[model samples]
Target: MPSTQFSLNIRTQPSREPALPCHETSEQARELVRGTSLELYSDGALHGRTAMVAVEDPLRITVSGLEDIILSRTPGDDEHLIAGHLFSLGLIRTPADILGLAFPDNDPGHAVVRLRTTKPRRSLGPLPGGPRIDPEGIFRLRERFEQRQRLYRSTRATHAAALFKADGELLAYGEDVSRHCAFDKAVGLALENRLLAGVEIAMLTSRLASDLAAKAAMARIPVLCGFSAATSAGMELAERRGITLIGRIGRDSFTIYANGRRLDV
Candidate 1:
């Protein structure tokens, strides 16, 4: 009798002391892929192989012991990411609401944000109108967004979100293994810079879903475009929120599922 052995292994970046949460961290920590040694089964032959794998890290966010959420995302921009997520949930209004962020026990997996205002969410009204965007501007934004996808280019395992002004100026950007987290990071970056009110448009890769629509609604972003198709729920949310929703973005064509007022048409 013989037994087959199975093993699992993963590789990570070199260990270093994570940044103290008292201050903002550098964007250099955006490396989110690794060269992994793995078993390859091809053409009826099993062999060893080396491949690029996405880095998925767990981040526990606690808001002064009031609210908590664990996000499975890439390993960077931890502070902004959490702030954006909290804001989208209507837990915090602006960056000033967060007094500070810290890593508990110096553990990167856990983060705590001391909040100055922890009021429950108020009514979520529809987004504002005006500040429409031209199609040409969307194309240019896509060009810039593609250039910033360092992790997705290597591992093809991450989604991205970018916030821009009505005139096509980029406000903030985020890329992560989780689509929701990516969008949160973008919003968080904007919040940190006090530009949340200026984010008139946002673009995200992958399928457009209701959750994203809700986040956009909560953040009051006027326009949202997704690279792939939008779910029915997403379209409904956009319509209700008065947000222009563009989906299935292609080289020269895209579909607007709802609220086309923000597009030149």
Candidate 2:
């Protein structure tokens, strides 16, 4: 794949986008990732050090009139995860289909979502068009996304999914142990705030696999970029779904895996 270098200057700006707040207790949030004291054998000396590790837990999703779906993900934003998962599977058209989420008093990991959708459970077709991303803007958004990944920075074991406006505004953010779950959480956040339609670009901290690409297509996000790389199936899916897939993003340039014409070419 070829990389591009656009000659536009980029600038960092303050966050003005709407972001959903996690309503969980701080202690519960902290439990998602914990710090462990361990021995660090660097060079030739062994020393005690505390390292942060992401905790992967099971989340059981129960949707109305459907079978249960279980996911192993970091223990936060369970509702958003379920919403995004359902949306990706075409179970419900929009967040409006969701009536409410009920969690067991004994098990916060289990979520039961009541669906009041009148439409069909499955959907078809490619995503809509309107997003145009500048290569320069990609670098800027990558910087901002990295700065916001507090858990990833501390643990380096978490993946993240972020949705950005074409102009570089971050619309939503999701971090988790699973790349797919991260993307779903971000989409779920956008859906909750009714901002999914306004989303232009989706960024992933990990590689762009078929699952993430499919999720982006299902969520109707036009562009999907990854910090690492894009798998062959992911590239094909993005191309078929009218998505511009970008990968191997570096400070100076990024590789366009498919649908370059949709970019600011």
For lDDT, the strongest prediction is 1
Candidate 1 Cα misplacement greater than 4 A, ranges:
1-31, 40-47, 65-67
**lDDT tens readout by residue for model 2, 1-265:** 1211112111123234422222221123326667678898999999998777788888887766667888999876776777788788876666557666666563667777677763445545876666766778899999999999987876788999999889888899999899999988888888877788889999998998888888887777888999999999999998898889999999998999988887776
RMSD of each: 7.9, 9.3
lDDT of 1 by residue, 1-265 (tens): 1211212111122224222125422223334667788899999999997878887878888776574788898887777788788888787886657666766566667777777767768636787665867887778888888999977887789999999888888999998899999999899878867788888889999687999998988888889998999999999988888889998888888898998877775
**Candidate that would win on TM-score:** 1
TM-scores for all candidates: the values are 0.84, 0.84
lDDT of each: 0.78, 0.77
Off by over 4 Å in 2: 1-30, 44-46, 117-120
Model 1 — which ten-residue stretch has the worst lDDT? 2-11
Positional deviation of residue 18's Cα in model 2 after best superposition, in angstroms: 15
